[model samples]
Target: MRCFMLHIACLCIASSLCAIGDDIDEAMRKSVPPQLKFLRVYGGDDESMPPIALTSRPTNLRRPNIPFNFSHVTIELDIQSPTPPQMFVVFSHCNADWSEHDNSFLNDPALLRTSSIDWRIAPPASVWYSYTGTLKIPNEHVKFNFGGNWKAKFYLYDDPQIPIAIAHFFVVDPRVETRLEVSGDFYSPRNTVYSSGAYTIDANVRSVDGMNDGQLNTAVFYRLNRYEEPFIVSDISSYEDVNQRTHAYPLQTMLAGFGMTGRRFRIERIPAENEYRVLNLADYSLFPRSNAPLRMLTPDLWRNGSFFEKSDGGFMNTRFIATGDRDYIQLEFLLNTQLIQAEREVFVSGSFNNWKPDPSWLMKWDEETKLYRLRQWVPRGRHSYLYMTGEVDADNRKAIRLTSEEFEGNTARAGHTFIGLIYYREFGMGGFDSIVGVAGGSVYGSW
Candidate 1:
């Protein structure tokens, strides 16, 4: 029975493997349920909301590009209900395009590792529970000797087939170095508030492996910090061979600039003390192990991308220490806004929500109080957040998508991190795009 299942898994990858578009999307939606959310696989400490606090990190950024490292990667999930369920995580190696590699199951029959997870009951303030699973890649049992994309699927430990959650991660043996520089309008000097942010990238791509030169088709992808999607330069410009070992693909593209005027006259900055207001329902704080409604938190203004360092009562640079004693803390977020125009929605986005506009973070306007309110149950720690309002796409099923710079005003002083990725598709490879190299840097506008 085990051999039959192995053969089936191999066949699925070899044929339907790495298939994108509708097939892959449908498969992912069917495999993972929606209620099991905020699934992440990160390295270092697992206690932080975002294990890696880099805002410029890729949405798909799961693991550092180092392969066969000793660092442990942890997977975590939040179930909306307090009931603890029997969960198991299964790890699999996949090609760059995220399909099961053909040789994965055949060569290493033990390529798939399954481990059970114990769910911890969250604090009384939270309506949900948290489940954490950790795995050290290249440990005694599993060694990811190769570089590529990988996946971890969570399922019932007893059934082990119905996937409840899924996460995609990357393991890279970086054979190349990608250096990027931004030249134009690094600082917003022209305007006091609305800076017409125009910039281009100066890139130097070097490959240690001689085979990765201008001879192959290479592309560069870049994005501003906190944005969900990236802009792609499909056909890079000025592709030249600088030397035998290095290739220069100098490229630049326009970035979206922020506007000066909006519903809120100017970007409001709240006092440092009030930022990331903490709610302690523990035995010492207000409501202890009781269902009493906590006090209403004071409303805070837009932070303008200011992060709360772990030292300043924030979670940054610190790891979450699970005591199995603290209850969940519920904090209310408010945006002072009169009447939101029609077809517009407000969201509070940050590293906590992967910097994306999730429905859970959407704030509803309270007419009586005249504030957009959101009650979120966050793990104990400080966090940074930004308020964003965008138009709801009526034609596209009323999808709420944010526009660059309009809602989240980007100032010259606002720190922005840009990550440059270079993907190389060698001649005659029917497989996925291998991330040859990656480079990232932070830029602040100078007026």
Candidate 2:
């Protein structure tokens, strides 16, 4: 009945999500993760951490803010034992229906693979063993049926009667900043919109492993393209002494594509020779459209605006703009839903403010503009912002859903990813915003 119980739980989550509205946003905000969400896990039978356990045995690593459909993931776990032990990990999503095209594969039932991890034999209960493994998750999506929801499970089968351990896994919602589409509006501490300004763009170049964050040898490579070719910004945003996460680069030097949303800049460990070797990613923006709902995919930079010390010192500018068209800038989303607003000081910071989310730098209300704003003129340059919502998912039970694949006749399959390139180009003004009009939304649950 474990499988049935889990299935029931997912269904309840799906139903709760569909019923949510502005009238209930307050009640739902506390229990659910913002945006769409999902959940799953694996480990020993400890059950302390539903999705994980504290054991030397192989376990799956947990990640947040992955796009719904196109977010491809391959989780690997290493195991060493005198005898091999049974294992399983749950990969689930939520929706009214969880069937694939042929109805043979369970859409969000569980993640299954023949070759996931190999285990070394261990002594029965007497010997303790462990294995090291990794999960390779790509920004890819899969769905069997034309339109439906299904979670999956990946595990080691010990026997038909019982199993070793299962890691609980689930899909989750992405935050506003984590949204792959639509750049938010830039705001200052005074709650003002700085549509025009010499902005600062901080270039943070590093591997996911953080191994080569070494003193970035004197030069920093920057490529900026407003949805087109990458322009190499060499010998810019350098520091007298190299720092860890980011290196500040000024935008005044940028020839074009400033203040545009699709503008993408990659900070590479390698400095360019002539200019960037730009590759076409269909639309060629920093973030890929393959993952819907969460558009505007500028990696590494925080959604809230960043802050720095001003040369003048009178006003501390916590917000900035892209310095070109005014489309790409720091935007803030205040959760003043009369629910979670009073308890928190929603602020911004991250790769934006060197990882500092300062309350002092938080935006204030602009009585004149009738909007919250954070504006100051420290130094005009292109810099990243860390948009802070200061709010958690309404409930951990809700999941963030993304359009993973295109089905036959718009009928989706089990693990098919749609080429969103064509669909994205046709988006009208406030391109990503138009997504709200979509009638069909994927239901999901969060951890």
Best by lDDT: 1
Give the C-alpha miss distance for residue 60 in model 1, angstroms.
25
User: If scored against the real structure, what TM-score would every candidate get?
Assistant: 0.61, 0.23
- Write down the RMSD of all candidates, one decimal each: 16.4, 24.6
Candidate 1: list runs displaced more than 4 Å. Answer: 1-37, 46-72, 80-84, 90-110, 116-127, 157-162, 182-202, 215-228, 236-296, 302-322, 338-343, 391-400, 404-407, 426-430, 444-447
Residue runs of model 2 more than 4 Å from their true location after superposition: 1-73, 76-85, 89-115, 118-130, 135-190, 193-387, 397-447
TM-score of 1: 0.61
User: In angstroms, how far off is 8's CA in candidate 2?
Assistant: 62
The per-residue C-alpha lDDT of model 2 at residue 151 equals: 38
The whole-model lDDT of each prediction reads 0.45, 0.25
